[model samples]
Target chain A: MTETSGFLTSNGMAIDLTDLTIDKAHKHLKSRDFSAMELADAYLEVIEKKNPEINAYLEIYDDVKKQAQQAQEIFESKEENIVTGIPLAIKDNILIKGKQASAASKILEGYTATYTATAAHKLIEKGAVFLGRANMDEFAMGSSTETSAFGVTKNPRDLSRVPGGSSGGSAAAVAMGGALAALGSDTGGSIRQPASFCGCIGLKPTYGTVSRYGLMAMGSSLDVIGPITKTVADAEIIFKAICGKDKYDSTSISGSINAVSPKKEYIIGIPREILEIEGIDKDVKENFEASIKKFESLGFKTKEISLSNIAYALASYYILMPAEVSSNLARFDGVKYGLHKKGANLLEDYLNTRGEGFGVEARRRILLGTYVLSAGYYDAYYNKANDVRRLIADDFENVFKNVDIIITPTTPTPAFKIGEKVNDPLSMYLADIFTVTANIVGIPALSIPSGAVIREEKELPLGLQLMAPHRGEHSLFMVGSQFLGE
Target chain B: MITRTDIEKLASLARIRLSEKEKSLFPEEINSVLGYVEQIKNADASNAKALQKETVYNVMREDINPDESGVHTKDIVDEFPKKEGNYLKVKNIL
Candidate 1:
């Protein structure tokens, strides 16, 4: 894929991965053309300069210099890894060994993971430097990261609006030059939504694709940890390193993923229904339709497809997510660990700790999860919701037979003002309408930064989400590369 | 038909306290939110179940090998409101 002509092709210190793909970056580093420290220093300098404007990171690791020093040693040692010395941000929910894994909640504030997550550990082995932890929605809830306990993560494109939730900080961190790439957990659109809102590339892998061993669970059935970066190629690089079987996470497919994306690819699927959403922004629609024409011009075939069961995705997602949350969150009972409060009795202490520790949106979700998963309502709601979950999965099973890849608008509208839909749960659910269907049906989806929407003379990047069936992520990369040209 | 009563009970179950205004607001908020769940109250999913875990009943491998991973009890408990000796001291249970 070649560079888009209209894009700002400035060669600067904040050069995105797409400018010089990870392969070029590594090839230069390996051949002693540019020292690893120079690349690390270039990214660190930008983050130091611009992070104050975006607030994408809660904290930047001070040990980055020491890690960079180690990367030089590995280069001198001539160790083999695809991304030796490249910097990446670990979304706070995914543990980075000793780093504070806050999940943007007060409860785990300052708490450190004794052991590293499987994915983080893998990257460390591959010689990737830990830039820092990115912020997210408290326990991966809400759409806009305004729900973060520490503070809201703003859209890099527009300061007034929000970066999308659960992985907003990760998306914005990369968008504003805080890090080269990041890892974010996507359960019910957490990764892809924020990527769209903040104008970065975020991949939500198929359900069993990535390990969830270290992530603070928001919804177990739906959660799959994945990459958020400045381009589709970078996403594929990170995904390759962290994916495959893990004994620690039973849900993670304990198998192998492609060592590299195959060159040959097939036609892309453009679901017609997604473009017809009532509130789909005109710019998003125009850009997506134009992108389709661009794909056609680039020798790719397009088809009108429908998976009507996607309509019920919100219902299935809310039900299954909460049910999983109800079970996963049971561990934080103020006894074994997490935040505790002063009280005269055990029960009161539990109440106060949860009250003070959890943010508003977390409380709302816990209550919602409890309401649906409660014993009396289980059969009437949760049980039936599971039944629909099956239908949603089948819908995908049927669709993959006809298309090689799926395409849709990553978000219905561009990033909204911080408080626009905070109070309205229905609108918030609708925010993930296009993204969540992939999670419900367990398919790999990527939200690629198409181009910015310059509204009122200000620019906000809109995303186009591409999905491939389970383990078919390569198809998206091959097709996406045609548009996100170098 | 969620009510203030329902919100209060739900809050109690969740072990949190809502203000009078919040308590009053939640029932309507929750009811309307739950109204969306009605979309999947019933649907055909004959195919999805085919992919579920093969074994149905408690697939628990007998924890004969009690998880050897040493979780520092004090490491977790020390992060509490108050501690007495070794354990986290808390309010009454009932």
Candidate 2:
């Protein structure tokens, strides 16, 4: 089972653990083809070789062997669950009790979580072994992992280009076979955009379908945790495991997920108005059109519709997200639990602790948020943004009445070179133009690696994004699986 | 464009000290981003129905007496950065 490519190439062992998907891995483990310990070791071997170049994992759990030992015991006792012995990577922002979850920022350096995030807790209870915490944008603020306080995570496909952001490390880990699957939160395209850039499947579940409890708050209204996996079925499996209500988060809903079996009928709507955006790469647009044609060949209907208000989605999100960020991030003062720097007095302490703790992008957003929420400007900026947000949601509601799912290019371009737009924050934010509307409307969306385009003799992946009506994840998986021919 | 004086006010309100360089740099960045978000002003809200949040509601939990609910008061208090036995320590404002 040794191979020149695709997982465990460096190991050159007879037992190839890299190519095993979730289903195959479960079958092999159940049949005792190899022990769970063996599987964990094989992944650890790959991480050792690849992580230095990729920088995907921030911290590999020291207790991996101990966790795998417990998982092996569970498997031997005939208590196997959906994710038994499955080693998954977690985003740094998600909390696991007694673990250093820093969200890749200096503000919470050396901070340990006192309790586990409800999502991670659910997986742990099912005998899933967390391999490590993945690196991400500091405070989940940027579109590229370059903003991370730790280091920039390079794209596994091309070392020079970024692996997209916020969830860049999670997507890269899964793409490089370092982890079978990983969890990432989407606030303004953090998950899907990276999932696309790194060539993986990333889902952003309908807001409130998955509990946000214990995930370090970014944009509170825009964040939803979902899975980044190698396959759509794996995404479905992880989604079901983590999607449920918890009393800890009042926003979570109980069993509100759409249970309708994916209908065989396929009617995909394309927002012609939004698709005709400026600055879309030639290859990306051509590939996007080619993906649409592939859907047509598979007996799916394609309709060109107008979602005119979608043009303003990015604008609305920028305003609303910062406004919420300014408020949510106010808690990290020099008090209680994180980094505390003493100064002359109370005011100086607050200023010094925050000024030194927060990164440039974070401080910029906070100031922008403050300005928008200031007394005289509140109605002009924040309120107007909310009204436009309502309009964008209404546009989706109207378009969805005639279409099962809306399709778009996940990003305007493939992974860009690191430092290409780092200095220009607005240009950096434009990378999320196509992916942010779903967050704005509180709907389920996914980014599936559509195809690849070669640049500098390297194949960088491009993703096709699909947006479904509220709780319409079933439709996304249905169409997504069909498109991927899984 | 927002002036440096306005940004100074924002920094004071946000309680974050900005250096001389940041004071100049942040205003330019903030103003550019504001320019981008200014497009929202075109959407009229005068007659539109108030925006409704799909998932926000007042949650009520049963009042469990401390005896019935197993509360770890010590563990909760231990999370504070500076604690004096069972109480939290903070700088005096008076």
Candidate 3:
């Protein structure tokens, strides 16, 4: 799309997807300026060169050349919509018929899709190129991409550091310019945190806004599929295209983009309790203040809102999400079609497959979920957590009743080094504290790259988040885009 | 507060072989998290009946009746750790 049109090299290999925006490529191709095959060949060269270091993709669709040949005909005929043969990456959790939908897990290691995931189908119908399956956490269960049965996906910004997860590869691909835009499923900060860590924009549309029919289930109530893009506008455009009712997914909502608040000023609520956690990174706090100052400058009124249940969000999320994840993922045990190992009987095969398939982090959550939902402990844990989930939701509902939007740091800190917190599961889960509430309350939230913080060990961007009532994404987008100085 | 034994038992039930190294790390983590859940144990949830759990059902549509879901079996076989002719190769079952 840019002057460096052909394949280029980054991270020691050829990267064809870099600088490949939908707008630039289409404009040139439609005007008889360039051919689609040439563009595909250019990217193929790049992928061949740069894929070793960035390993963002799991399967590189070799037949893409044929698809490009077809698209070239359309471009020659002078018809190119918003996406016409634009190369894009789909997270492995979502199925694209005929492509392997492993979710990067060993159990379902090579399973191909019988039905294409809804979002991928829509993107394909619009002429978006399916580059390949991107790597992700096994079953979309962990925050860091490390949990992926596939090896870790490094941050394109800094090779040694992580890209963030469970949609880490999706964010890294977009950040490293490997893909124009990537569709990632976010549940408890998966999309937003990785985007922040990689210095890109991640939008978690209102729950049920995007269909999740084929997305590998993590927390069914919390999981949402949204785009991780370089700019908020691109994120908004992608959100608009894939959102709406789908017969395949009953969770899909009839969310309207037109419920945009036109007020010149908005009341923004900041809960002080969330900010008080120890080890809250200094740079994130500073960027948050500066971001708030900018919002105030834009005529937004700020208040320190008191919603007492904030302290318990992380606890409630761990309990409730794992319970849902445990139930949703129960079907993946060997017999149905994920992983199968030979055993003297069916039981050993099921146990071995799951044992080998899931990562430590995933195993921990599954165990916790199984415990909480077990017969004796149901009232003490799961039922009580659900009760608390209500309290947290009520807190947000009441807060939104008085204010138009709520803002917080999308994550407590920027991306830590690859192994910094992986050894400690609680610390890793705590990293999601700022984001878990949006899922718990079922509200729309957006995370925009606020500013970069360069620590001695690492330099990554911090995210300033804006949350709105359910179906209030337009306002969240407006405020987030406004804060990012769009 | 969840004890180390509780974390260990949960780990065992979940079937992840938590080495002593990890076992030591979780007691504190689980407790700190459960401490937060304890507060929610006291929230007024009389009206939370519907908001907490919604019964979900699969919406099955008329089959495409194409005999198969259209997935290639080759790709699926190739992804296993090890494989044989049209089969997944693994450790002996018996």
DockQ scores of the candidates: 0.49, 0.64, 0.29
* lDDT by residue for model 3 (A1-486), tens: 112444432323333344545666666566545566666666565556656887778888877887777776666666666667666778999888777788888868778776688877887776677677787877777677878878988887777777888888888877766677888998898888888888888889888888998888889989999998877777877888788888878788774575655667778998767778877988788888888788799888998898877777777888899899777767776654666665665566666667677766676677668777888889978887777778788888889888888889988888878888776676788788888888888788888887787767556777888889888878877777777666
The 10 consecutive residues of candidate 2 chain A with the worst lDDT sum are: A1-10
lDDT string for model 1 (A1-486, tens) is: 112112221232333333555677788678766667776776677677667777788888988988878887898988858778887888888887667888888988777676689888899987898888888888898888878888888787788898998899888887776677888999888899988877778888877778888888887778899998776788889998888887777777755465324655476777788666667788888988888988888877888888877778887787788778766766776664567676777777777878788877677777878788787888878877777777777777778788788788888888888888988877887888888888877788888878778766767778888888788777777777777873
Ranking by DockQ: 2, 1, 3
Backbone-clash count (model 3): 12
Which candidate wins on lDDT?
Answer: 2
Off by over 4 Å in 2: A1-13, B50-56, B63-79
Docking class of 1: medium
The segments of candidate 3 whose C-alpha lies over 4 angstroms from its true place after superposition are A1-21, A41-46, A77-79, B1-39, B42-94
- Which residue pairs clash in candidate 2? none
Order the candidates by TM-score, highest first. 2, 1, 3
State the displacement of the C-alpha of residue A319, model 1, in Å, after optimal TM-score superposition: 1.9
| Fnat: each model in turn | 0.55, 0.64, 0.37
lDDT of 2 by residue, A1-486 (tens): 112233332334344555667877788778777667777877888889999999999999999988888888999999998798888999999999889888898888888887899999999988898999999999999999988989999898888999998899999998887888999999999999999999899999999889999999999889999999988989988999999988888888776566545676969998766657888899988998899999999999999988867888999899999899999999999687777778888788889999988888888899999989999999898888888888788778888889998999999999999999988899999999998999988999999989999999998999999989888988999899999999
Model 3 residue A59 CA deviation (Å) reads: 2.4
Docking outcome class, model 2: medium
lDDT of 3 at A410: 85
> Which CAPRI quality tier does the interface of model 3 achieve?
acceptable
